[model samples]
Target: MNAVSAALDDKAIATGPAGPLLGDADFQYLRAFVLEHCGIALGDHKHQLVQGRLLRRLRALGLSSFTGYCELLRRDPHSELGELASAISTNVTSFFREMHHYDLLVDELLPRWLHEKRREGDRLRIWSAGCSTGEEPYALAMVLAEAIEQSGSKVDARILATDLSPQALETARRGEYSLERLAGISAERCRRWMLRGEGEYEGLACVHPRLRELVTIEPLNLLHPWPMSGPFDAIFCRNVVIYFDQPTKQRLFRRYAELLPVGGYLFLGHSESLHGVNDQFELIGRTVHRKIAE
Candidate 1:
């Protein structure tokens, strides 16, 4: 038995009714399944993490064991796959989590992109790949809106926000959040771009219709074939690649390179790096890359 399975087997046998235990075999099966379907490589050490995350699903479905859950996935792979992905993956995000990327977007990228679009009369497109719960795309919209207002440019721009989690995408489509989620946004921006909830909806805020109009949220699994064609000016795929294995990261980065033109920007998570993975992009800022070659 693998380490994770061995560790959990005894606990699972002992802990009856407290929760359904994730067995060794089940963990291995799930590890491989998640890697194959979502490009997320769960390590042996993550067995406990997986068990904890999936426990709620077990209860929700009235499942008695992890094996039963696995069987359910096997029985209906198409419908249940998304639920498995939602349960296993992490979706921790906040508005303007990485502030500097937006700063760079407003200061450098938008101006150049807008200028080019103006000359060609083409609309601007940005891909917020792995956008979770709307923060990243909304953040992009806010910055782009501010840039357009300041420059007095009649630039038509849109953000295509995608995520593997359908639940997260639902929340993103709603474009509503509790007041706590609106922290760190400036008062002027809050007033201009967000609707302050009142009365029964106190302590809630929603993205203004104008801002929401600039973004389109969709369900997309990065591991699967992408349908939309893109030569996006910039792509924000931050904090996402860290979950994948090395080869998966390499392939994903190469795909991102293919989607961007020379000088197009690609933003990554602060902790992620392109070093030794793909050299098509050059380091332009902290955790930001500019596609330098084909």
Candidate 2:
């Protein structure tokens, strides 16, 4: 009868037996819940996206309406919250994404870091926050491995890769990907870093144990308390903060600044910037910031 009802009816007819219609109220409730729990600020235009993503959960729970699903979430927030976050959050990523970061790591950061750690002992640490599907961290592992080999330094380098979604973390831990996901990776590097599958597992590639040895994948929610006490050498948190509101972004950046030692590096998503968010880092390269020396 009303506009929202009409939209729902149209969507139902169009989808031809799609899951329960997501109404305006339902969207708003879910949006608020997600924002509060996960620090992801969903815009009004994301109603359709949220609806589409949550439909699977709705069907899985055998819910008849979005309202019922919301009630279930509210009643058992902890158990259901992770599922909600997983469903709504974006996990799009690739191998060597934002190649410039890797270039900087190899050309400048790694050399400088290796020199500094030579004095501090042979230890180097990097964190790949929001490392989706393991590609980013694996790429870092590959670069670090190569850098150690080229420089002939016994730099005990390691990467800590974390993501909020258990599902994403599981996939990352498996470290196996299809051929289509291997785009931009060269044949030579692929042979060195990944184990190619054959026969039934054709076209799939698994990360080599040598490479996997350099990365530790774990579940972490950036919005919540961090258990690790870190003054990491560098952190790659690219393309992660764009979902948060300005204040949330500011808080997260401040936390990053605290976690990074003086002169450490912070890498952001290409579209993300610290210009208005935080002042603790100086822009050294495209989408890259170095912590101001205290």
lDDT, candidate 1, at 73? 70
Return the lDDT, model 1, position 70: 78
**What value does the lDDT take at residue 274 in candidate 1?**
97
TM-score of each: 0.92, 0.90
lDDT of 1 at 236: 92
Worst 10-residue lDDT window for candidate 1 reads 1-10
Off by over 4 Å in 1: 1-17
- Tens-digit lDDT string for candidate 1 (155-202): 778999999887888999999999889886878888888898899988
Residue-level error in angstroms, candidate 2, position 49:
1.6
- Model 2, stretches more than 4 Å misplaced? 1-16, 119-121
Give the C-alpha lDDT of model 1: 0.85
Sliding window of 10 residues with minimal summed lDDT for model 2: 1-10
